[model samples]
Target: MKLAELAKELHITTDSFIKFIQDFDLELSECISTDFEVKEDFARFARENISFLKNYQKDLEQPKTVEDIAGNISQPADKVAEVIRKEKPAIYENGVYRSSVSSFGVDQKLGGDYNFVYNYFGKRMPLAKRDFIGYRDLFFYISKALDPFANENTTLTDWGIHRPAGIILYGPPGSGKIFWAHKIAQIIGYQFKEIKKYYLGTSFVDGNETSFNDFLLETMKQEKVVLFMDDFDNVMMERTATSSVNSCDEETKEIILHHIDRFEEEELLMVASANTLTGIDREILAPGRFDVVIPVFPPNVQERAEIILYYMTKDLSDEALLKQILEKNNADHLPFWNEISARMKVFSNTMLIDFTQSLKKRIRTQYLKDNSLDIDIKKHLQPALREASAKLTDEYFEQMSRFIKDISVNNYDDFATRIENLKQELQHYRIVEKPRQAIGFTHNSDSK
Candidate 1:
């Protein structure tokens, strides 16, 4: 059964259930598949412990403090505070330092025993074998958004819920916004069509000029199509009093807004890709327009490992030299890639693939020279790692910081864990600039 369905049966939000798993230190991999399938054993545990899970979720709903967490987990308040100091920032309110800090993160840091939660594990369910790696939370969220479309007997309409007319996928460059856009189309059985640059402007079509309006009218006539527009942030940016706005982009926004109301009725979904939602005009994001916002996060640590391994041995046979080297170094497994992946915090999917490509080439060269099975693979990986690490520039982090802040404000409840994890990962590169002291002024009291 799917984890979302299990959550629905338990009368709890999937976000809360995910939090429960994290708080108990339950192995997420063992309990849920990459496709968000709930292992039968974990499902049984949840059904039997429904009350316990509900009560835990109740505790999670309220803003918590160091004392609250310490009491709940039966640990010292100071220890909990220490853990929170490193993990998350505390919000002060009502005469207390409080925040929605993860009790699971705090407990793990305090060495709290959570083995009881794992007793339900009977046999490990293999990850729903997919070309994609992690981001199960994201997939589940998207599934929920498209539920009305998937279920023929869905009463979502009674609750005033309908399929979204538009979905805005926002993320940093190369985080795979376009990939998820295609995935969304695939899920709904819609034909994916890109709104090319020429389609957005007056272009010669069959020796006649056709504008964006003509393109929209013709697209709406189709049965089911997802009209994708990339670089949406650049086109739909907020127009300030003194800011220069593009006439073509303004026209594009106007055109989308004008025809957006009829999108759902016509079985057409318009999906736009943007680097960040911070700049999009508020009018364009209004309800019944393009309000369904989904974030495409860069792969987390575990995901990075999986992606690296996937690319490293992509098409190599068992007898292949690279395969032999990987097996010899035990680099074929996920754990072997963890340390390096940990260092590649906040790297995009494109960057990770580049890393694997670089590593593979270096390994091939070394093999050609040494002509040995054990060709000191680690020695070649260093340069490849350096090459990939170069892309982790200051500008990229700036973009991610904006993305994190935007998600925290708009979709915090749904993505709290990811927001927190990314914040922690970003801390490594966030250097505080100390003020420079004058060179000539040193106190000579000791010398005197």
Candidate 2:
């Protein structure tokens, strides 16, 4: 059998098979060609390794207490607890250990309502208003939409209470549109259902539109669901337009629109997100279809500061040390944190996260190179900050700024107004009156 065939039989990646070979001190060429035959001895070795890895993975998957893990691994419970505390601290709340809600092998039964909910959102972490750092008003608006049904007496139409059929979250890419959608679902006590592009594609290709629609409607009828469709523009693109690479066919577009229309009678909450509203079908955005359209802009100065602080120090347990690091970075002369945040006005949450991760990697690399037990925080971080700052040049900012402006102009006056108001709110929004020495430090050092 060829190396690729061997990898396929083992149900592992080709790169992993290469690594397995290297682990056994075998001198094999890096270019493991697709036609390279696997030796009998190596095939036996690979099978053994694969069996061991699968068993180890199964152990991890099974829910176990710290004591159970310690006993199984033949280590002290304290050591296991410490490892959990360092890695997955959220699971160690209230001095009791809990396992993460896993959804492995559950995607195959997408037609089942219960399995669909459990598979997609069973493991979602609980979120509060504060968790949605910058967009509190938007969060509250969504909450209000679901509040009527949440209360028994107020849901009566006689009392003039009605649930919104749909909401559109539009903005530049990397903005927290999808994140807020899931958070809204969690807050409103709804099972979140994400409708992927490929799901639609597969249904159409297999001529299963009716069956798929039935499955979706059945799921909605069974429970109060937050149905989310990301990249809505692609699915609802103008039927007449052929400019987009993945433009929706008229039949597919009509099917999606028909589903939106059904939301009028059903008590379902539909949330759709898009980077732009340029080419979407106008019917999908009609009043009854998507009741409210909101714009999610990039974070402002204070929000950016908070985002930076959150990502940078999320893993650290030493509150005093975290405070010192923040203070050092936000000092008057350097103002490293403030300056970086201000400079990143065009950055979305994802971009800011990636930049912070790069900075961390640089700091870690330098610390490792110096062979030091203690990190010289200032010595390594300042240069990384400067490098990150230099990378987001004027040209990049200008390009991103133009993209935001262009997308905000969707040919509808009311929609444009909402986008403008959002930008203004973010511009004037200040989480703190003045930049604090330490923005996110807490008294409870254990809290992440």
Candidate 3:
């Protein structure tokens, strides 16, 4: 019989039965199949292992510790604690462990200010303020703007002592804009609320203007909120631009601009990201609407090396195997890593991450198929890396280069000053040797 049928017969959960079998280091071929044949030998084996199964079931029935729960689900303890706070609110408040069902809401609606705060910021992992990879100057500027004590030395009524209303981060897609947004919110200790296009649509109300305005008002009222809007240009494109189709109608665009004029509350910080600055409304890019507009470029050579090493070390859990791979391709230390990064100069951070994840999957599949851990990573991964590199064609680089040049020429003074300032800031910071942890939710964080 299948493991599900066996679990039914034994009056235990399939997970519990699987864990029992795994604890003994026994691999059952039919465990994952729902329609496997149950021979006499399999029945006899289960009968022989009945006592062990009973013990496991009893262990499952007992109260679980925080570590036990985390290990069982392969999640961090902080995530478990947050889920407990959500699922068993009274138990968490009482500081008591009780037998209760834990319902993880991965797709639950985020309605009001309170739900938005608890759902996003409350459950976020605690990361160091300096954990952001690059873009030191941009991060520093934004942090100062969000800081409550930024203008402590200046007079309160001074004209120069005004809080920034919002920030616009424009860059190539998959260039870590959203990641930086989340990290900014975490550093400022504010609840994050991301306003999507659907949230601004007419489905919620008879008119899209009402829906958009309501979202803005709800977000603005929160005492500590970082409102993020991804793809700013898509939502607030120039009404007169003729190149591409606009998602928002003229009335909707006018409503957005009206709200932008009124979005000067100190309690709320607005941050938006777009792939390019072209075709964006001039008014939205005006000084008061979005006080800061920064352009994020692809990673430089040093930053690329750091990113590659981070992903390579983070995904390859086997320390010995990782060391071997790093030493491969040449006698010099870390030559393999340096070589890979050099070859992947055109890769964005997101592309690097995807490539590493793909390589990890291939390695796992090979290991399982060969029934051996000994495999040549370089031999297998180099070809895959080349395939990934092929996606970054000459046309892609030309498009990106043209966009950068256009923005620079359009705002020459501001762009030149910002680029020079970034260069000076980067001189003070070196790439620290550390593995990058996966951001946001992971497989373990999802519901089973």
Candidate 3: misplaced stretches above 4 Å?
Answer: 1-130, 144-149, 152-159, 205-210, 241-249, 315-335, 369-372, 393-395, 406-448
RMSD of 3: 22.9
lDDT of each: 0.80, 0.56, 0.57
Query: Cα lDDT for residue 23, model 2?
Result: 24
Candidate 3: tens digits of C-alpha lDDT, residues 242-264:
55545554555676667765565
Among residues 3 or more apart in sequence or in different chains, the pairs in candidate 3 whose N, CA or C atoms overlap within 3 Å are 1-38
lDDT of 1 by residue, 278-395 (tens): 8799998988788899999999898898889888877776698788899999987888899888889899999999999999899888888878888776787679989988889889
Candidate number with the higher TM-score (1 or 3): 1
For every candidate in turn, the CA RMSD to the true structure comes to: 4.6, 21.2, 22.9
lDDT of 2 by residue, 1-448 (tens): 7665776787765445543332222323221211245656556655755765354345535677767766665666676666555434434654543223111111111221333222322222212213445443344344445555444354655577556677777777777888878876776567889876555533554654544455566766866788898877777777565465443345555666678666646657788897666677788777767756666667766667767766776666555444454455552122456766765645668777876777777656865676643554556445655555554555645435544565445322323333443355445433457654665656676454
Cα-based TM-score, every candidate = 0.78, 0.53, 0.55
**Candidate 2 — which residues are off by over 4 angstroms?**
1-130, 144-161, 203-211, 241-249, 319-336, 373-448
Which residue pairs in model 2 clash with each other?
none
Reference-based TM-score, model 2: 0.53
